[model samples]
Target chain A: MAMDRTEEDDNLPRRLLDGCQRDFPLTPRPFGALAARLGTTEARVLDAFRDMRKDGLVGRIGAVYRTNTVGSSCLAAIGVPLDRLDEVAALVCSFPEVNHNYEREHAFNLWFVVTAPDQARRDAVLDAIEAQSGLRVLRLPMLEDFHLDLGFKLSWS
Target chain B: MTPDPIDLRIVEATQAGLPLVARPYHAIAERLGLAPDDVMARMARMQDLGAIRRIGAVPNHYRLGWRANGMTVWDVDDARVDALGERIGRLPFVSHCYLRPRRPPSWTYNLFAMVHGRDRAEATRQADLIRAELADACRAGEVLFSTMILKKTGLRIASAAAE
Candidate 1:
């Protein structure tokens, strides 16, 4: 049964969000491959993707680099009050470098990811955030990377 | 191609992981009573078919003292998203980059890139450099350091060795 996507006010873009993730195929014929898997035409797939850009369902699909191999990295967060959460979250998200930022149900309401070349530069990035956002920065670097990569499967159960 | 039961079986076996042993393929073949090379060849084909991405190491950043991870989102003009995204993907620091749709009133990012480092400080710092380089491309940005390490699972491709 086709689930009602109208819960979000009958939005077609929202309905296609999951489908959009499906739209990107790992195969070389990526677009066409994904389209065939989804039982749609490549042109339609392209159009929907183009439409998605105008609408803003995601920022970009790019590589998530490995920290240790490359050079350096860091994780930083701030305790933004609930009221100004969006403002700060937007500020944090506005930076092209800040990828996965979220408001967990906690005092440290605003969280974000930061990357840089070395420790000195990494610290500078944090400093810039503190200066621009004016939120006290709680520096929490990773002791280790236990597990990563949560692959998304578009094949709906 | 049309997927048969054997393909399905392969999928089931590989979902968890390929064994952490030298002869993982042989172990798998033993269960199926097929030659190890046969299993390896099938795996190679299935991987080549895009049913599985790449078989590689997923290091624990924390263990290595490089635990910082960040996802950099970009809001670029629709006209230049793909080109700009391709450029971003090329950077050595960039591991995963892609184009995605942003749902309004809920999410407002159209491009996403991830960066990993030895620790939180290292990750956040790299994010800063990226932001400066992208100063013209994006209007705003922020970094969120992970407070807790979340669930990390292995292959979900259901190839024969994982199960």
Candidate 2:
């Protein structure tokens, strides 16, 4: 009985995240509708999501744009010296256009994305980063994107 | 295609996220000084135009226990890459697959597939599976696991200031 209860508790967040990935009802009482579908109260549904967000399990309930549609973006990397890694990273993060920066395990360690209103603006941001850092930016622009599943299926272990 | 001013405003408003309220869109509409009907209609149109991919929850995979994120880069033959990339993109474990430009000598990888797993071992196994699928078409490949997230913010537009 305890095992059953635990499983039931675990299922709510997983179900909510998996089920609401796309086609989220664009209704006035969206949470209420979601609660009805999940066979729970509206408050409980909201609480579950709130907890997930606070815990960092979910980033946001928002729209994922098709790249180059709303704006232009490209993946860029820099091989910063180990001693000056943090300083350069802070500099890279200073740009509003630079989003999704990561320290990946590679020779070209600092990887980031730059998005701007148009190609010219995007290129300008890249150029600015290069001029400031004095590091050659490895620009890997997407030539083709093979669309994947709209909703990421969570593998519940 | 560039979104008109209104559509751009809507994207800017909700790009961060929808408010976690009973009437999320209605809340957004009020905040943006637009009617609920207008907000819904515009969002639907954006979806139709492929500007908005989908309206949903964006999960932080690392926090969700898929801790190991491996970016597998492949140097595949340019002629056959698109066909192979589509197949690879459809794989259950591969989250994002794209054909990117390659710079010779230092960088020869033109294909990138993001693979997520519970740990390094699992992610490596998944990469191995992709290698087998590619066979000789893939000249070489490497998996670059992220050591840290220096910064991560949702897409932001310069003109659209968040309230």
Candidate 3:
């Protein structure tokens, strides 16, 4: 009985996570529909969503665009000097085209993704970054995208 | 495909996020000066055309306890990469897998897979599993752990193109 209760409790968030990650209803009252399906109230569903967002579990309720469908994009990396990492990273982030910029444990420490309306513009931005930072930019455009979906199932342990 | 004025407007309006309310699309329609059904229809069409992958919640893996993420890169034979990439992508633990161009002399990795785990050790373990899975087709591999996320934002194409 205790195990059954625990399982029921665990399924709530799991169901919420799994349900919302794909084809969220386009209805006016989506939460209400979701609540009906989950055997809960709209307020309860909304509350859970709020809590999840607050806890950082949920990034956002939004649309994820297909890669290179909306614009040209490429993965780029630069080997910045340790002392100038921050300055270079800030410079990289200044570009609105650059969406994700991160420091990784590698010789090519600073990496980012640049998105532009066209291939020519994207390459131009890369060249500009290389010239500004005085660093050789390694452009690694996606030859094939195997798994595009980043959403993963949440395991409640 | 170049998006129409209406599509661009919709993207700009909701790029940050859809309002978290009972009638989110209605709210979006109100802001855009369009009817709710029109907004919904356009969104559905965009999704069908693959302009929008999905309308849903994006979970932050780091906050969900998958704190360690390994950006695993592998140097696989270019000829056989498509077949191997497909197999590697089917792995449950691998979230994102892509075949990227390899720049010689500095970079020789053509395959990239992102594996996430609760800790660095777990991430490493997953990378090892991928190594074993690749067998001989994978000539060399390295797992670059992300030290910090300096900036992370959803891509927002300029609505200027609409005009």
Candidate 4:
């Protein structure tokens, strides 16, 4: 559902998206703390979350783990013939380890991120993907992360 | 920081999402039979150790009006990539910047940055700025706009592997 942003209701959703992108309260009553900070009631804050979630605006309210800190991860790409793109993509997406998979315009047309508890396991998944897809997997492990924050401010226009 | 059994349990419970409640930690604590303070403290420690990046809402950028998402890749001088990447990554429009190994013959772009905008034009504008910034250091680059999101999900550590 698209957000019906009126003058009054718009600010809360905008504020909630911008303010709570990171550093959300780690307290027992987090919504209560967020409510106090945002100058709203606990119930109202909870309601906003529910509404936003139902609208598909909010992905989740949870912990974002640091890369390579919790587990090993790599950006992988595979070149599939245009005709077989859908088939290849489905095979790649079958693994739970593959969190993100995208079809981009390139010789290496299919790109995805594979994450596992350790390097060995991550490689194993990649090998399996290559074998199953009948395509060579180009494993590109992150050598360095320059800009890591994935959050962006929302413009309520 | 290696996650203890309790920490793993916490991650498993909340990886999907935190319960939407007044006292989410307390609810999690109840499920695990631990004190609310214990759960909170552990989470705090994890954040401090860089195990947990943050505890917050993750808004879908596409849903939030930034529809054009481009995976801008660059083939830059490997020797100078670290310094150049730092500069490129600092740009407000670039959300994620990373250095990944280049595949020979078929692929040569090693630096990857994701730029987002409300539309294709805005996203391309950002990519142009990045190209200009890189200047002579960049030999070639391509902005592959995502046609579709095939799969998207939060990273879930296998419970069996957690032990």
Candidate 5:
């Protein structure tokens, strides 16, 4: 069984996450800064990070990968009926290159991101989605990414 | 390595949607019947394996006053792409940068980046900074602004086979 939770446990990840990137101090005992705030020793904090990784809590401790900076990509959606939502979505999502897929409550039932090696392939993917799903694949190519940041505040409490 | 049940469970919970609150993980813990620390620990582990990416926000740029946003594609020479990409990505205006799988023949640009600004001219200036760095190496480029936002959300972790 996992260890029992205490109130103190809830305030650690947020601190580390906050300090990890923006205000990371460049000095010895780097973990000390985090450890001091997290109420655990530097080693425990380090070990905690190791344990978290072992436990599958975090995906990475690096820079967030921005999805739009590659070849060519577009956001596409299709309005599948409630009955065929799953079926049509699967067809749209069949391509391995489709990075993100979602089931939205909006009129266009299934939506996903089609990122290709280039514009032609990008359009081809949309065409393929339309062909396979039998639904109008509304292609909304991004004009600009005004504010895209994947940084979420994961409070430890 | 393959993911464990706990891994799948964490992904399932996280994938469904983010709990709108000051403390989402704790709320997620309440919903999933697992200790909050357990959730955090599992997330740390997934981060290590690269099975999942970083956890962060999906802000609406347009709503935030950055009315102009464009996905800028660059046709940089293979040799200089690395350096130019680094410079482009460092600018606060540029949100994303990556080396995509080379889709040649029709599309020649391998280096891609995005710059968002409060308005069209501002966005163009942000792109200009990148353009200056590339100089003539930037053979061609284009900016396509979003006409409509069809759908946007946190990623869903479910595979079709899940159902």
Candidate 6:
């Protein structure tokens, strides 16, 4: 059923977003290979990708490195006063090590991921955030990943 | 495993994205002063090492019409979390699923799964499906819908990784 839904939405641009989420051709002419698989011209694939990228639909075409494999990172959250939420979130986002920061609907509103060279450095980053914000930061490093990939099959219905 | 200096260079070069060209690897190799074959071989090795999860395009879910992004956390029995997490991770709607340590009193959820939907109602409906899958093992659960993206540039390795 899900497969059928995906097949229904099959097109050059949709395939690029859904099909190429993983196992993207690693050949010399990747665009050519993708074009071959999708039954389109290499130029068409490239143009479609460029357009999607320019439109902010595609973040990037790259490798999704495993967290804590090459470096270290942890998901930490902080509960800030409602009034101070935006100010604190900005402070958290200022750190280069802090890659992803989001304002969620919860008491622990400010959530972010901090990446560093090693465990020691990662801890130091959390500490600095704590010190600067004057609030406790809850560190939740991933213990295990149950999924092999983060690919999502889009529905066009 | 830590990437060697050369592999690190390869990672850094492609971190932003593979070059938009006919021969992307050749482009990376030319810029890094390495052979195209060498670049591809190193990336393949990195993928085997589990250092590179996958090589592909990352779509901006919101821009793709997945507006409701929910980080659904659940409190499950410690003995059953790993098993349940594996099942949850396979769900069509769950983009990411992992087991993280419980921070206690304030934070007791050990399971975190990311679900995307076109709207909040759809996102909630997906969460309910996971709840049904977990059955009695799930003691509590809450979906944290992201209200704003303060920062969202993917990981920066060259600057932070060991030199």
Measured against the true structure, the TM-scores of the candidates, in listed sequence, are 0.47, 0.94, 0.91, 0.93, 0.54, 0.93
Count the clashes in each prediction.
Answer: 84, 0, 0, 0, 31, 0
Error of 2 at A102 (Å): 0.7
Q: Tell me, what's the RMSD of every candidate?
A: 20.6, 2.8, 3.5, 3.6, 11.6, 4.4
User: Over the stretch B40-150, how does candidate 5's per-residue lDDT look in tens digits?
Assistant: 666666656655445532334555456675666678887777777777766676767766544445345566676777777977887778788889777876655544443
Predicted candidate 2 versus true structure: per-residue lDDT over A47-155, tens digit per residue? 8889999999999987888888888999999999999899999999999998789999999999999998788999999999999999999999888988655877787
Interface RMSD, one decimal, each candidate: 17.3, 1.3, 1.8, 1.5, 10.9, 1.3
Q: Pairs clashing in candidate 4?
A: none
Estimate, for each residue in A1-157, the C-alpha lDDT of model 3 and write its tens digit: 1223345444666678877887788888988888787777677677778788888778788788778876789999999999999999999999888989989999999999998877888998999999999889999998788885746756667
lDDT of 2 at A24: 79
Highest DockQ among the candidates is held by which one? 2
Please write out the lDDT profile of model 2 over residues B1-120, one tens digit for every residue: 457888888888998889998888898899889999999889988988888889888999999989999999999988888889999998888989999998987799999999999999
Per-residue CA lDDT of model 6 for A1-157, tens digit only, reads: 1223233333678778878989987789999898777766777788888888999999999888888877789999999999999789888988888989999999999899998867888899999999998999999999999987857777778
TM-score of chain A of each: 0.55, 0.89, 0.84, 0.90, 0.68, 0.90
| Quality class of the docking in candidate 1, CAPRI style | incorrect
lDDT of 3: 0.85
Instruction: Give me candidate 1's TM-score against the actual structure.
Output: 0.47
Q: Give the per-residue lDDT of model 4 (tens digit) for B87-112.
A: 99989888889998887787899999
Is model 5 an incorrect, acceptable, medium or high docking prediction? incorrect
Residue A105 accuracy (lDDT) in model 1: 40
What C-alpha lDDT does candidate 5 achieve relative to the native structure?
0.58
lDDT of 5 by residue, A17-131 (tens): 4555433222234455566756665655565555444444443332232333324667666767989876776676577557667664455556578765457877887888787
Q: Per-residue alpha-carbon lDDT of model 1 for B27-93, expressed as tens digits?
A: 6667667776776666556555554444432333344344566766666666766666766666555
Q: Each predicted complex: what DockQ?
A: 0.02, 0.75, 0.65, 0.70, 0.07, 0.69
Q: Order of all candidates by TM-score, from best down to worst?
A: 2, 6, 4, 3, 5, 1
In order, the B-chain TM-scores come to 0.77, 0.95, 0.89, 0.91, 0.80, 0.93
